[model samples]
Target: MTAVTTDPRTGMTILDEDTCWSLLSSARLARVAIAIAGDIEVFPVNIVVDDRTVVFRTGEGTKLAAAVIAPRVAVEADGADPATGRAWSVVVKGRAERLDRFADIYRAEDLTLPDWTGHPKQWFVRVYGDQIAGRSFETAPT
Candidate 1:
């Protein structure tokens, strides 16, 4: 396991870009937060990451409806290392758009959504991250 050494000037633990991308790619699930009817709703989704976009399947419910009209959304994923007392988290702010039939063809080759018990409409949402930020936590030498 690699350790995080803090920068003396900024006092923030530095995580390399590759390390951050690795963490993002390794995450299988993410929490997608959307605004609906003046209420903030968060849904746990099984997502597949494609470069800077996140794709997932959902039913024609609140999440789907919101994404169609309001594509602006937030998605987050994180993990922590208990032994090292270190943790990392990344948040993606992006817009969600419904996938068209043409785009579906490409996604089919690269991603698959397992069948589950739910409304089987199989709505697909693609989130394009406009801004991505991440942070790593480390305990100062005591």
Candidate 2:
């Protein structure tokens, strides 16, 4: 864990980039958001952090189609301790590109991501971490 700076106004703590990346790397589940038909949609996926990018697998569907249309997307993961109200969240914004090439897919196979849906998730998407940010805080006892 890394040091945090508290925001007096909101009583929240700001997490640094290194901390954010570490959090993301340790997380297994994340929410991926993309714009489709002018409306933004979010989907929960089993993700793995490869270097600085978020990688996941999906079958041919809305998410796969949306990525083809608009590569820019946001991936977020958050967790908290309910008893103490200590929480943290990380957001990654980047272009989601499909790995259809044999070499690309082969390289991604090394990551060994499991598909929870138990479907044939042949398509792999990589969201390059262009902009990453996160926050963590300890709230007053409720």
Candidate 3:
């Protein structure tokens, strides 16, 4: 059975770890946030959950460059059931490592992450989720 938590302050609900993982797996797109030169930036990318880790692909660009400098990153993915007015959001904090080894790259290829752009995305970034949290809320009726 899935557990649900209710907040006393606003009646919002908190999701358990199991529920969070389920939502993460169902999400196809997420925002990868990283700090670059002391400034924070968020980039939207297609992602997949693998072994409890969030994986995505990017090419030689600001996103890759920043991840190289700052290994730690935070990722956020969210979804809502419009009919029910129930929404859930998940956030993961972890270390971002670039996979360069042939074996690692080969394994990542199996993920089959899609790139919306036609450009080739060779660089892969795997975020080892160290801490994860999620929450859900039922909006007031319209």
Candidate 4:
């Protein structure tokens, strides 16, 4: 539980930083959106939460290239609780950097994450969210 903001019209709850980070810590799948070559591209990534940062593994491709270029990116995750008719979404906007430091790389190695692609992912990228926010709302009745 975080900021209990209820919209006067919609009853939407605005989540605070701590609640946002809590949701991120429990979620493993997120979409990373990056702007590259004058276009916006989104990538579905398997991520691990390192405190307030999001970390994922990638190969030398657009995802890696965009991170190296130092562009502001967005990582978003959402969840729905049907029984409670509640749906929530959290977004993290920040810069993505490649984990090149020895300590960072070593620590990342210990973070066991499943690779659905089963490809050789040798690079670790961390997204530092400059702004983080979330909202919770009641789903429309069927």
lDDT of 1 by residue, 17-58 (tens): 556556777787788898866888888877777776888778
Q: Give the winner by TM-score.
A: 4
The full ranking of all candidates by TM-score, starting with the best, is 4, 3, 2, 1
The lDDT values for all models are: 0.74, 0.88, 0.87, 0.87
lDDT per residue as tens, model 3, 34-131: 98778998989888898899899999678898888898999999998888898889999999999999998888999968885668898999999989
lDDT of 3 at 100: 97
Better of 2 and 4 by TM-score: 4
Worst 10 residues of 2 by lDDT: 1-10
Best of the two (2, 4) by lDDT: 2
Model 4 lDDT, residue 134, Cα: 96
In candidate 1, list every pair of residues with a backbone clash. none
What shift in Å separates residue 16 of candidate 2 from its native position after superposition?
A: 1.0
Top candidate, metric lDDT: 2
Which scores greater on TM-score, model 1 or model 4? 4
TM-score of 1: 0.75
How many clashes in each structure?
0, 0, 0, 0
Which portions of model 1 show Cα errors greater than 4 Å? Answer: 1-18, 112-121, 139-142
